[model samples]
Every structure is written in C-alpha cells, then in structure tokens.
Target: MRHLALISGADANHTLDALFVNAPLRDYGLRPRTNDYTLPVLGMAYIATYAQRAGFNVGVLDAEALGLGIEETAQIVNGMAPRWAAMNLLAPTYEMSARIADKLNPQIALMVGGHHAKAMPDRILADPRMRHLKALVLGEGELRVAALLEDMQRRRELPGVLWRDPLIGSRAGGVADPQTSGQMLGPDIDTLPYVNRAFLPQDPYRAAPTPADRRLAASRGSDWLTAGAAHGHLEANIVGSRGCPYNCTFCGAAFSANPDVKIRVRSPRNIIGELDSLHDQYGVTAFRFVDDLFLGAKRVIDDQMAAFTQHRIGERYVWDATGRINVLDRCTDQELGTLVANGLREVALGIESGSDRILTAMDKRIDAEMTERVARRLVAHGIGVKGYFILGFPGESQEDLDATVRHIRNLWAIADQHPGDIRASVFEFRPYPGTPVWQTLIKNGYNPDELLAYGDVDLTQDGADESMRQRDEFNFSVGIQFGGVPLDVVRGTLALLTREQHERNHSGQEAAA
Candidate 1:
C-alpha cells in the first residue's frame, strides 16, 4: 500500500503592508511580527503517529520548518505523489489553505482540519475553488484522518468526511460521536517518535526589509516574519505540555472544551534530556518554554527543578516562561530565587487588564491587586518580570481603558520601587477567530466583520510593521485594540514615554556624577 502524507500549515503572519506603508489598513503600532510558528502541530503530529500505528505509510510536511513556499511544497509533494495530501487550517488561514490546495496535482487528495472547519464546516465545503478537494476531516483530526485513511486503503465507506452530493447539495459521512469529537489519541510525550528533522527544508525562511524580497526568497503566499534579538542566540521554543487548564476569553475556542487533562507534562527527565540534547547536538543553549503557563504548578516546578539539578544541567542554559500572577503570588521568595538561580532569566505574567471589572468580564480569573502583588514579589527576588496587559474587552468603556492605563502605570511604579525587577508591556485586544471574545463580539453585535473577513490572511507579514520605525521604543505591542484610539495619538504617547525615560536616565547620571 502506498503511504499517505499529511501536510500541515501553521498560521502565518498577516499582511502589514496595508496597515503600515500602504494607505488602506489602519497603522497600529501595537502589531508585532510574531506569528504562530512555534506552536507544535500537536494535532497533526498525532495524526501522523496514529496513521503510522494503524499500518499505513505516513509522512508529515511542516512547511515553516521546511521553509517551502506553496509551489515548492506542491512540487515536493507532487514528486512524492502521496495518494492523499492533508492540510490543517486555522480560521485565519482558510484562504491560504484553499490557495495551497489549488497548487496540488489533481491526482493528490486535498484535505483540511482545524477550528474553522468545526465552527463553520459548510463555509469551507462550499468554496467553489476548494469544492473538488477530497475531504474535510471534522473534530480532532488524528483519529478521524487515521480511520479515514484506513477506510480509504480498503475502499471502505467513510462517514465523518464531508463530500458533495447532488441530491443533498452537500453531505458528511463517517462521523464518530461526541466521545470522539476533536480528540487526538496518542502516547505520552516520552512515547512519541523523535521529530524527523531530516524532513525539514534545508533553507530556513529569513524575514527581509521588503515584501518582494521575502517573497523572492520564499514563495507566494508565504509571509511569516521571523524576529530575534542581536546575539543570533535566540531561544529554542519548547513545550513541556500541550493543554492549558484555564479558558480565557481570548484563548482559542478549542481550548475551552474540557481539556484532555489539567495538564499533560513531559517528565522532568524527558524535558531536561531534550534540552541537553538540543545543546549538545543542535547547538541550542537558550530556551523559551512556550506553554500557556509554564510553572503552572508550584509542585511541578519544584519537581522539574530537582530533575534539572540531579542532571547538573541548570547552568548550561538560560530560559524564559509565562505563568499566572497568582502562581507567583503564592510562591515563596526562595522558590522564585531558586528558579532564577537555576536558569530562569526572565518571566512574563499575563495580567491582562488592571481593572477587576474588566478582568472578570474577560474571565482572566485574577485582578489588579493580584497583579501588583506578583510584580512586587518577583521584584523582591531580583528576578525580571515582564508584565503583560491588554487594553480592550467586550464591554470595556472609556473609563475601563483609562483604568487599565493607570494600572499599568502603577505596575511600573512598583517596578520603579525596585528597579530592574519588573517591566510593563501592553497589547491592544484583537478578536481572533478561535477565541471567546471573538464569539462575544459577534454576540454583542460589535461589528467584527472586517476582522473576520481578513480571518484567513496570515498574521505574519513579510516586513515588520512600519510603526516599528516611528519610535525609538514602544510599550504597547501585540494585539492592539482595533479602534477607539487614533494611531497618531498612540505613537505620540509612546514617543513621550521614550523621552521621559531618557530624561530620567540623564538626571540619574548627573546625581551619580
């Protein structure tokens, strides 16, 4: 039997040309070059695993890692000519997927899976360009695709897949029930196969100053801008766990469902072992734990630390992670210090908004008070804390926005009370497709039509946002509010902040003199 190949595309950068250099889209400084590449295709990875387990020949195409454009990717696939080619689609990248699907040879079966298919399956099935595609796997696609592939091999009927029928207009088949909805059946982190890095493309995509240059380097429909700091020593993004316990309004809709478990962590030994191997083999020394909340549990943190110490690997690496404010508040200073001493160079706490009202409305589960306490505690430990805040919410008013700004100021004041321990970063809220607020906005008639209209565009632009050039520095970044504040005013505010900081440093220099 011929092997089947599953090609998954992660969300790419949105086009910022219209927002920045072009006149059409609004120029919001809040936009960041960050795209969704680091997120492991946990779903697709499992599908590959399951299909392999089921005795079908299987392969995975991770386009970002491979640095292949749609045409290049299609050529690679066409050469291999797997009987089936599947691509995962996020709500934002449906159009991209559709275009990529068009590139495949007619002989290859085109399939898609992800949140957009679940929420609005009909919309995807109805696209005339994509209508002739082989299938759209519903729910968690690993099992669905695995079973569908098995059936296909045997020429068995498939019920969970969507297909066009002349009489019914469009119909779906081979669906397992609620129990199997969107579930990926796979092994614990240790049981999984090592990622076949050999399949990754030889040339990695590099971001450029111009869109045309990036396109020439990569290919059409590829626009993810990679970001890094000076040393060329960027951290290796890692995941100790897949699922998060919290269901924030801004988190993807798929996350809101009862998570498979509170958490499913790789053993501390497994984690440290991987980190060590990454260093020794891949020359990767720095790491960023991109879990929804790393150090989610105090006990887990302690356990992992013990493993690291036992392995004598702590000093070999530096790391950063995100955790809740409450977790830090509950930690003793010693525990915080220990992590820092071991390797934690910096930590970010998502204190989304300062107002208790906004926090509750957004289901953040913590308030301004807890946020302050956490910042202060991290400061006391001499650990750097990056404070994360968001500006807009579903019902947020002008007063709410002002309160959030002041709260951030107060948070900054706490850092000032203990310099170098804490810093502030703010993001304007964006109603992304898979999140609660996206649905909430629709529920409240907030007119997110344009956002949804651009939902399938990649978030990563080939070039950095033009606003990045407007100021020497900026605090309000990533997911900025779509409206309410003028872009010029936001730019001016950032400029003022930059000037004031420069002045303060000058005065401090004089005092030292």
Candidate 2:
C-alpha cells in the first residue's frame, strides 16, 4: 500500500476573488469553463518533490486544476484510499479544507500546511472546523513535511506538528526533535525536481481524468511532465530569489518577520542556465521575477543584469518584476536604461503612499518627490512603471488625503508630459497580522478580526469625498482608499483627475499651435 498520499485537493479560491491569491488558478480565462488549466504553484511542486524523494508511495489529487468541487475531490480521495492525505492551507482555502474535512473524517490522517498555518497556529488549532485534522505542519513545510512522513512510517513522533489531545490542549504529536530549518531561501533552486502535473486533469474543466492521470495513478514514470509539452511557453513560473528587506506595512507577515533573510539569491549563472532550459524546452520567453524586491541588492541585481546583457535574451522576451521606489531612485540613469535594454519591460514599484506622513508611518522611506522623479526616469528609459499607492493609514488627516490625490494627479501629468511612459495603480491598506501597523492598530483599538473586510468599508464615513471634490488642480487619479471607499467615488475621482490631465495636454497643444 502507498504509505502516504501528498493529496493537494484542487483549490478553488472563490472567497478572495483575486486571481493572484489562488495563484495556481490564474490561467483561467474570464469565462469560467470547467476545462481551463491553471499554473502549478512552485511551492506545492517542491513539497511533492521532497516527499517523493524520501521514499514513500505518493499520489496527487489536484482538485483546483481539475475544477472539481469539494464533494467531487472527496470522492476521488476516497477512491485513492491513501493512509495519509496532505492539503495546503492558504487564508482563502481554509473554509474549503473545513468542508473537505467534514466529508472525509476518520478515514485518513489529514494534514495541512502553508502560510496561514505557520502564522496563526493558535487560531488554526482552536478552530473547531479544522479540529478533525490529524496534524498541522507549521513553518517552512517542504523539508519539514518530508521528515514528518519518514517518522510517520517508522511509527515515530512528528516534530513541529500540532495534534489534538482530549486530555491536554493541542499537543505536539508524532516524533520529537525535528531538525531545525530556517525560513531562509533554499540553495540551488534549479536542482529541485520538476512538478508532477499528471494528477490534475489535462482539461481542468472537463472533470475527467486524462491519460496523464492514468500514468501518474499507475506510477509508471517518476517525471510526468518533463517533456514540457503539457505546459506551453506561458506555463513556466520561476523564482530566482527569496526574501525582501523592506517592511511595507501591508506586506505579508512571512516576509516582514524575517527581513534580514531578504534578497538571498542563487548564482546568476545557475539562474541563467535554468532560464535557458526553460526557454529551450518549454518555449518560455515571458518571465516574471517573483521576488518581493527583485533589485534589493545592488551587487546581485547588477550581476543578474550583466548576465542578461551578456546572454541578450531581451531580443526575444519581455519580463516584469516588483521593487521598492527607493531602489529605482538610487539606480543611475545608465543602469536603468541597461535594465530596460535587457528585457526589464515592466516594474511594479511600491510607492505605498503619496503623503509624506503616511509614508513615514509605514516606514517606507520614500517621498512624493522621489517617487515622481524615479517614475519619470523609468518612463524615459522606455520601461513601464506601475506606481503602487496606499490609502487609510493611521494618523492620516484630510490634508494628507488631499496630498495623495494631488500626488497621483502629478503622476498623470507626468504621463501626459511624456506619453506612453508610465502607469499608476492605487490600493487601500489591509493590515496583515504581525506587521508593525497591525500591532499599532490593535493597540489603538482598531479591530482587524475580519480577514476579508479591508475593502468593504464605506469610504464616505470620513468625509473624504468632500475633500477630493474640492481639489483645484488634478491630473491622473487613483481612487483607492481604506474604510470602504465607494467604488463610484473612486471612479469619479479618477475621471476628474484624468480630465484635468487632458486639459493640460490640450493647453500644451494650443501653445504649440
């Protein structure tokens, strides 16, 4: 009998309604069909690789990719009849697992792991919905989970795994003394085995297994998707680095808690080598640098760019990445141009707020002037810049809100001043657990009990609309605000701001005439 089954029930993240949140489900087209395919999450693939390497019989059930509902996934798992079943836990999928656990109780030792499990162990343990879960793997789970399966096979205890006990509160069950593993970035990422994509149905919408599924079910070959034919040029998603140094308030807690571990990178040669294979085998040209801050370290970023320049893949491909505004500001004009020349076509710059006070409150270390300067410079270099802004920070006043509107207006003006240069995005603040702002909000009596309530507030609660309507000069507008800023207000603000920018452009044209 297969001792363990690394069952990843296909996930459907309907709760968040944001595509990136359910990451693997991103490839689904707007019209939701039963047969759309989603990219396999790299993390889950790594976990499956490590588990298989540890010598246990493992099978996968990717319900999300199959577009199977919870009941359908449970039926499949019941059919597989593995001794232990493992599921990944993200904030949005917590309820999904609860529903699955309710249906498949007492048959399998269900285990859950991921960011939500690591950050909120106490809460996860206490939730009655997940009480039936045999164990919850906390912290960096890939290596830890592999160790856990080995111990489970030997009838030894599992370390770092929380189990329910009637006599005492949830106690550590399984093996003792699990080896210490840092959340630091892993080494030689390219060496990890390719993900086993066979378990998921080829046509995710059809709810029918493919020939690949039969091959994976029978365990005929260890490398199921190695031929790279299944995933087109667009299916590849690679991470070259781990960690971010900056402490953006709204950023996820996993990143903020371990800031020093930020910017750890694999060798440029190794990264480039993988890129070449991905390009050759999978026909992948469009790549995304999935790091928190891709250009955090000057030396590493420069080295990677140098490699890109030497190899010159820019002729065929385009790429995008995320970075801090300060990083771009510090970059020389020549370096910025070099980056664009080497295929850095798009950047998501975290200019969290246009107001200096709010920026200081978040410890962002960037000002409006610096943001404008760097954004303009990126545009001049023929690189697209997307400015990220935040609203509804604590200690913000009406004046600060006005400043934000004005700041976005100035950016729109920049775009008009130099057409086809830059674009801007506005977002509201969502205080994640364990951030400095979260703690402050807690201390100041602001309740954050609702995980999905950040974007649901009524923005007019603070008379923000009156302030925005009173603005004398405007350009491009971004209408994201916390406290439930009305969607229409946001639209109107953006329209007003755009109209002002257009008037400015017309004035310039008339002067030329």
Q: Which candidate gets the maximum TM-score versus the true structure?
A: 2
TM-score of 1: 0.68
Q: Write the residue-wise lDDT of candidate 2 on 260-336 in tens digits.
A: 34346767777777667766765655566766646656777788898888887555555667777777788998898
- Cα RMSDs of all predictions? 10.7, 11.5
Q: What is the lDDT of residue 135 in candidate 1?
A: 69
Give the runs in model 2 whose Cα sits over 4 Å from its true position. 1-40, 53-82, 153-160, 173-191, 194-235, 253-256, 259-263, 419-421, 451-513
**TM-scores of the models, in the order given:** 0.68, 0.70
**What's the distance in Å from true for residue 3, model 2?**
22
**Which prediction has the highest lDDT against the true structure?**
2
Stretches > 4 Å off in candidate 1? 1-82, 138-169, 175-187, 198-234, 253-262, 416-425, 446-451, 455-513
